[model samples]
Target: MSSHLLPNLTAAHLFEAILAIALVFSCLLGLQVIRERRPPAVTLAWVAVLVLLPMLGVLLYLLFGTRKRWELRVRQRPVIGCETAVRPFDDAHVLDRMLRRLALPPALSGNDIRCSWRPEVARRDLLDVIDGATERLWMFIYMFEDDASGALVLDALIAAASRGVRVRVMVDDLGSFGSLAAGRRALEAAGGRMVRFKPVWYALRKRMLNLRNHRKIVVADGQVAWTGGRNVGDHYLAAGKHEWLDFSAVIRGPTALALEEICRNDWRFASDEPPDSSPVWVSGPQGNACLQVLPAGPEYRDDAWQTALVKCCFEAHSRLWLATPYFVPDETVTNAVLTAARSGVDVRILVPHRSDNLVVDLVGRSFLREVQRAGGKVFRYKIGMMHAKAVLVDDTLAMFGSANIDARSLFLNYECMVIGYDAETVIPVQAFFEYAFARASRGVRTIGQIRETLSSLARLLAPLL
Candidate 1:
């Protein structure tokens, strides 16, 4: 029983162990700080996973982060676009057929559409229309960059609300982070209300980081609705980045009601309020152009908008025009394009020669060979970036929205878009597409093509987009 015989633990050993634990905890805390403003729940979840299994937890988040950002289609259908224009809609006859194949109420044109070439112009005119109203203004956007242009829109909402207009706003956590604090302050000071969706802090499995609120719309008095690819930011609004080009469409009718429903759902979800059913949506008369709000979000139906677009792409009997900055398509969508093109559909894809997201551009290149082999032609816009997200099928049916061709737009983020089948409405949209097309150059992507084939890793990540 000699005390000297007992093994003595050194002070240095204890100190080293303490330091290691502190280091891990410090890393976890630092990540949370960097991510900032995620939902309190998300932040806590991250903490729990990391605390429980630090190294594995970190690895899991990295692998899944990219996938988590993508909104994957939960179901598939043969066709999804609603043909609304009576005279121009060749596909309207398929409504009865779709009732069984797609399980969606056959859509018909019930709204007036006004297309704007620039996102900033769209933003101002939309705010003006919503501000001009006395009843209510609902503004929902994925990104609200902290810049002068964003302030202008915020001020417009403010002035409207000051005059007794009920204004509600929703902004996503990830997109708004870099510019959120200032925007939030101004909104509060203006007597306007704003809520951030899914604020996740850095930890393992950061809940809100990948699932963004990507929908952009402004619904006023249930009469006018604005939807498109433009987020509220300098680049999208072409505020600082004069070269940035985007598209948006204005809607007025029962379809507008559907957009309003989406905005209401977003606002309520983002807000602190216990959601009450958005006052019974006031459906309007069937207007000249038929339209419907196809939605895809976590709280709502999954990838319905995406499924609709892919189906329409397959059904394109004539020309297919697609414009998106990011072109990373999941296999199902990629295969759909290939099938349509292989079947002799005249498919053309328009993408930016230089996009803000380089990885996305690379991921898009990862699919060129197959699309090209299927008789699809790809163009890279050289004049400026093409941020337009629209599709024209047979020059009859058309679509516009925040949805990108990439996995992020379809399955991961909250996306909203409109489908219409009016030559009256779509002719102008087609003309707009042609204008952008004229400025673009046919891509001779030998380098990109080879690289794409070599880099199977990127394409493997496509479904997670």
Candidate 2:
């Protein structure tokens, strides 16, 4: 054979070998997906993709399909078994029981809860907590920008550390990549500590790029706590064209200790250092509000938060109100909303007129239309980006925290939610909903043909997103 012919033959053989390897790998992934027993639609989608597009399918599955990571499985389990200091209200017995069965902490009374709707107020409340800390301060946020707002909060933390208060901050490596260096240098210089949750390079090396820490929580002295959708950024603190409307709650009581437990678990996972024991609750009950703290992520065996949310939709007796920045829900949640609205329960959903992501907006329209067809009302906020994630079911249950109504928040990321079961917590959340509803534009009952077709196409990719 000629020399050039031999080179070409070698190249062709290499290509064929690569193709055979990819085919075998794809088949193995398909079998693994089936054995996992996911939703029927999801399973079919994976099988089709793996069979038809072997190389691309293998890459996509490695990035997004895998649900659990080996590193997390080997890490320490979450701390539980915190005894409920007080019983939940009679109306909330069912929800309390459901959470208990999921191995979540029970609802406890004596929490003094306060909600902040406006950006300025939320910013003030956060600063106040940082400034007033006397013993220890812990914060876990997804995004921490290097803008003016971030500097203000960092300065406060530095001062707290200088004053002998233990301060620690954990931020998502990808979400806050732009400011991580500056934050780490400044905090460590001031005698504080900072760590990144699943750093981007580490996640990419491990083929777990899609997993993220999305929870935003701050605990001060193990007594006062704050958790919400707003991250530390100029858009979340300032009032301007780029401002975002969000919600946050400040809790002063035993519930704060529960929030601390969550922080400790996350810190341990990120830093691999044993967390300090929780401080003793000396002052006792702060008020009469009842609250439960739920932490959910891929680390858990089941989708505990998603199950609780679906149950809330089915348990609503008189009303169900949901507000979120994103509204792409899975089949189970979609059907629950449809059934609730069709059963004569007052159902309403509030979302931003246009969110930051175009694909999410298009995918959400199809889901929103289904709810509208079932007699549920939809409201689109027009004044600014609506970034709050809250749910109210009748007058007995209320939820507000970092998780949105989309698949990423519900199934992929680390999320925390505070469930309140009394007038003290529910009344404020209800008022915030009413205020936003009045400012938002009602969803039109119709859309153009081209838009409808685009939305339907986008719905096909919802599972991957």
Candidate 3:
């Protein structure tokens, strides 16, 4: 019948139109990828997703594959020609040369580093420093809760602001959205400035839901700074039922100026406020610690943390000990660790037994067998969640800050770490590792059937973790 033929023709035309639209969209996406010029592996992965999954793949890419904002990129351009003004104690180490090549501020000596592993002690020190702030106070925390401990910090900031102290607070949009209104209102009402770093709505609008500023930095009066894995919250500070074993370092010296500069750059990027180019360099050395600050994130063309960490693994002749709550290292890191361990390096990785992220916990377990096979040791902390992020190489080198041993931290998140080549700074972090190792249960190559199955499935999605 003519009527049936017409209906069939119409349906076929509609299907053809849909297919054409999809093809056009895929081509456009491919072109955009080419323009961005990402790494071959990342580009291929994205292209494969687009080709295989069509609309859904494109949607996922839109949500997660975008780069850092143009504003941030522009702001960081000056670092390219920035000279390393400070100098390290030993310029002989290959690490120092690598850092200098990256255009990082020189490794400065005469810095004092005090580390605290106990939650209450760390919080006490943090609050004390805040209370003692005189000139300027800047805090960039990923999570700023309104709970008991958080309230104390907030009140301290408010009081400091009221007393004419310059205070600026920056928190991650998604991580601390619940505290946004209250925190801003409390701080602004007291004359302090506050801004959310890359708000979630901004990310959604820009189709960039993956990048987050996860740094926890506190700089007071440009004289001292505190930073590490701990955020501003009751769980991270107080002795709660589910307390975490966290570590923070209080640093004083010219290194504090380096930390203050990091906070200033981040604050200016988020607020678009006039740059604070005021010098905060100390007139004299505060101690004898040699420290180099490494600020890593998606803004840079190269992954600073990844490069440094890989070099740290490969260059270690004696020992390499690392600790983090998450351990989903990329293939490069994994291979480097395996190669180093097999070469008789005392490579050890410490992770928490009970992690805050279930997927990360499961996926982390999958790497244990391979590491063990390479003669490396994996230790699981039985003590509450160990949220410390630290690295110890031999006896003179140590690093600690907000980075994790995972793809997200290494390549996605805005993170910072201080690399110290002095025993004064490295010794405490090494001691902390020793303490955690003493309380850790050495990894077994096998696990229960159910967990093993879950972990196997989780490891399949490790790249996304």
Candidate 4:
């Protein structure tokens, strides 16, 4: 019926096959060379996938590449009635009493911030006040494992929702990739709303790998709030039977208003329903505490946390204390710490003895030499991963929130932090420094020489962690 047409079709198919095969082969080689300096195992795994399943492999890499932060461009409406709105708490004494919830500075730009290290205490206190707020609840987490303790938190929220609380939860789709879908189903069935951040689909539209919402925050009654490193997973509270050292806090007053605003902004960007803090919590007779809320993300022009830390370190009158699970120092941070130590400032850094991410762990160790040489002290927690991000400056200024001392925290992830100038708060935070140091392993680096030959190359690539 058509020998000529059949021959043409055959020729076209053969050409298509050759071009597709050749294209994939070139992509595989390119990935290999680009990853030549990475850990051998990591590079090999990356190569194998791209070569064996070029389409799917490239898609996977684009979704979860070696990027430290990931985000999107979405315009957001400002929160009205934001507690952070400039206002005076009716009774100076009353506002001061509520401000006591936070370790505030004498004053703040808009609102103040207070930090609580007792994760459970913060959660319980916030919930007690949220008991009858049957309007709404929203939460986001980087990870959500199916564990008993995690279930407990879920149950509580679900119970609240059942009682007419509008509960909505969003989890990092890629972070909890390996979990069974049934886990999320439980929340959905319990009258809670659930969604995943960037679930993988077919190919294309993948390259935005560096953006991730590593923020942990909870808002109840749109008045009280909690934000920190504590995710909704059980391992955070030792509920997974392997709880190590983790920290979080309860922040209220004006700063809490900003906290609520920030969370609502995020929710708006994600679900297209911008949040409005109508009748938002207002500052009452709170103590005269100076507190500032710090929130940063990919769209931010400057890393506020990093700037504050650098300032704190350089201005330390006597001592500085920092607790972080990961430690990947950037140039400015490294210099500030060094200068502070050299200036006779007692500088102490607490990092997890073992880190969840190996790449960052090595980079942290790599910077030890320079830190010690400058008279700074580096201590590794022995009991467990020291997952507390606390910076007590001069025993007079204190900061706590989601940001770490690492580059990821400084520039990559969506992080929140609060700084205050209060001895009452800073003193308690610094007092615990000794206990942490007691449980930490001092670095082997000699004074002034940061010899981290072990991971120089790794640190070089960490700009991508």
Q: Per-model C-alpha lDDT, please?
A: 0.68, 0.85, 0.83, 0.64
Residue 237 displacement in candidate 2 (angstroms): 1.9
Q: Of the candidates shown, which would achieve the greatest lDDT relative to the real structure?
A: 2
> Which of 1 and 4 is the better model by lDDT?
1
How would you encode candidate 2's per-residue C-alpha lDDT over 108-209 as one tens digit per residue? 777899998888888889999999899999989999998889998989999999998999899998889867687688888988999998887787777667
State the displacement of the C-alpha of residue 193, model 3, in Å, after optimal TM-score superposition: 1.7
Better of 1 and 2 by lDDT: 2
| Candidate 2: regions farther than 4 A off | 2-5, 35-37, 70-92, 275-283, 448-450
Order of quality (lDDT): 2, 3, 1, 4
TM-score of each: 0.77, 0.93, 0.90, 0.74
> What is candidate 2's CA lDDT for residue 4?
68
Over 1-465, each residue of candidate 4 has an lDDT whose tens digit, in order, gives 598699999999998897687567648654643543433434566677677766667667765544322243323344344344333555232223333333321234333344454545655644553464567776777777777656667677777777877887776666666663775677677777777665655212554445567777777756566676777554575432366566666655565655666666667655756455444445563445556566666545445567677777766879877888877777778778888889898888888788788767767777765677778888888875667788887756777777877766776677777666566456656755667788888974442324445456666655455
lDDT of 1 at 52: 70
Give one digit per residue, the lDDT tens place, for model 3 in 1-465.
999799999999998898777767877887777666554556777888878876776788788877545446524322221233355426446787887687666687777889988889889889877888998899999999888889888988999999988999999998888776876888999999999988888888777679999999998987789898999987899987778888898988777877887888888778968986543446367777888889888666667898999999988889999898999887788888899899999989999877889877768878867788789999999978999999999887999999998888887899999898878878899889989999989985587789778777777676677
Off-target runs (Cα >4 Å) in candidate 4 are 1-132, 201-206, 239-241, 274-283, 286-288, 445-452
Q: What is the alpha-carbon lDDT for the whole of candidate 4?
A: 0.64
Q: Report per-prediction Cα RMSD to one decimal.
A: 8.2, 2.6, 3.2, 8.1
Question: Ten residues in a row with the worst lDDT in model 4?
Answer: 97-106
Candidate 1 deviant stretches above 4 angstroms: 1-108, 202-206, 238-241, 278-286, 448-453
